[model samples]
Target: MTGVPASAAGGTGAKRVPAPKGKLGAAAVNQASLWNIANILTMVRLVLVPAFVVLLFQDGGYDPAWRAWAWAAFAVAMITDVFDGHLARTYNLVTDFGKIADPIADKAIMAAGLISLSVLGDLPWWVTSVILVREIGITLMRFWVIRLAVIPASRGGKAKTLAQGVAVGMYVLALTGPLATLRFWVMALAVVLTVLTGLDYVRDAVVIRRRAIVALRVAEAEAGAVEDSGASGDSASDEAGESAAAESTR
Candidate 1:
């Protein structure tokens, strides 16, 4: 239920997750206003970030009641993250703003969750650091190679996001005994997936970037060859005309 939109996924990966059903649908979605339901859902997630953070720290940051409220806020944000992308794709409500804002909202909430947990000493700093670096680094990598090609989201990427959301959500609450130990293992798996998926993205970006560069060079070379051929023909025609004129004058 919680994941990044394929459209905005540098981490989620390239090629929109749900393909527009038809050409008309695609066109309509592209032209949809920024204020559509999908974009609004994204905006809602953005607003919830601060609300979740505030609630997380309330009542000395350890009160179960306050943590429950914070978890509610986080849950709402995650729920909206899912609905926004689905509605946008299914109803042809996609917009440029949605594409840009959706992922940002996703990252913002995750960052808030991780940082707050770390700050409260509930989660270790290194765990948060590793995940954040992967998330942020892959995000930056997406923009870097965007002009060349989009990297499609792999199954691994989806798994990574799910593991992360579940892990973080578990941590958001005050768990005990078996549940607490379970969360640690889940977080461990999330970390592993995070690192593996990150390396995969790096490899894909490099490959795609290389292919784009090679394609561009080949196109340029062919165009230059065509121009050279045209020039040679023009020069021959000119010489022929001059010879004919000289022969006629003689």
Candidate 2:
């Protein structure tokens, strides 16, 4: 027929669905190129790490004005940190680059701030050491278990980040009296949350790794069973063929 058949375009039978126009765009976004907004924000934070250190140390490293400017840079980094993650999650723009670079950026800025304060005698060395160990250990653990599964950031982890940021920002500034004491308490809270969340992450990693191992064993068993069944069927077919040939010879 000159016209397309009814069953082909509009019929009660199976029909071809037209591809959605936005499907490719959605996939590209979800795949999240390195140039995506989230990753770009993460890069900005990383770049700010060095800039913050330079600004913080300007004017003999004790100038309140310079520290204030350093604080501004840090605040911008921290704010972008919040938005990048939100955008990635909300828009399905998550990517491997974001996963790795995001955490690294977070650790770099916080680590720089903490270490700088410690060097300046503004913060205790023990506080910086404890936090650095925990942060580095958790980051490594994430990579260790990444092949099996991802350990998502917990609520406690988020709280810890906020507390650390606020406490460190306060430390970055020149505070005294009640405000300085308040910052101490805030940092104490951050430390507590850091240790607790670190333990939680270890637990989660163990559980996820165990589950992954179990799942792998189960899959192997299933595949072996399937292979054995197919082999037995083939053997049965061979036996039947031999019996038929013998009967035909008789």
Candidate 3:
């Protein structure tokens, strides 16, 4: 009761509560729906991945025409990744499902494309292996680190994605004779960006781990202090009540 205001006491003198605005109204709107345009885009991206893989591996060879189609599909899927997040923020369409599904879809599409390209001998297996390992490792790290800190996409990560897109697109185009020479250059750029971005991610994970340890220690200290304070307060209150009762009896 020491911390409680007089108005909060059970009495007729209580003041009327003020009408809530802004965030309260926004929260009401947020609770109304979970589906939105961003989620639709994510679903579309997921649907496109299989079709793109089919195109990439059709006819037991990388047919130039199918490769072209695959490139288009991959490009569209990548664009949807960007658009989905943008639409989510712009339209306030964020949802837990969207957050979960979006990354899964992205990883699936990337894995399919990379594996197909590696199988087709369009890109070096070593390059794909390194990229795949980094992607999977970082994803797992993200899950672990999220308990303590947020891991938003860094600029280097975006650049790495762009580099991969260009590399894959060029590799697909290389199925046609005219673009074959450019494929190696694009892939080389991609490899460089991938290695740098992977290192950056590893560094970020280390920092996140350190921060998480610190956060856990701080949280434990705070919880212990709260428990100590609560116990002391209760003991003191009991003694005061006993003293008052003894005085009244006397």
Candidate 3: 10-residue stretch with minimal lDDT: 23-32
- lDDT (CA) for every model shown? 0.91, 0.91, 0.82
Candidate 1, number of clashes: 3
Query: Mind sharing the TM-score for model 3?
Result: 0.78
Candidate 2, superposed: residue stretches over 4 Å from native: 1-32
Give the winner by TM-score: 1 or 2.
Answer: 2
**lDDT tens digits, residue span 125-224, model 1:** 9999999999999999999999989988899998998899999999999999999999999999999999999999999999999999999999999999
TM-score of 1: 0.86
Residue-wise C-alpha lDDT for candidate 3, range 1-250, written one tens digit per residue: 4787667874577877766566565544653466567888999999999999888887775577877888899999999999998877765678888989999998888888788888877777998898889888889988887877887888988988888877777776535555676777777887788888878877888898898899899999999999999999999999999999999999
Rank order (by lDDT, best first): 1, 2, 3
RMSD of 3: 8.4
Identify the superior model by TM-score, candidate 1 or candidate 3.
1
Steric collisions counted per model = 3, 0, 0
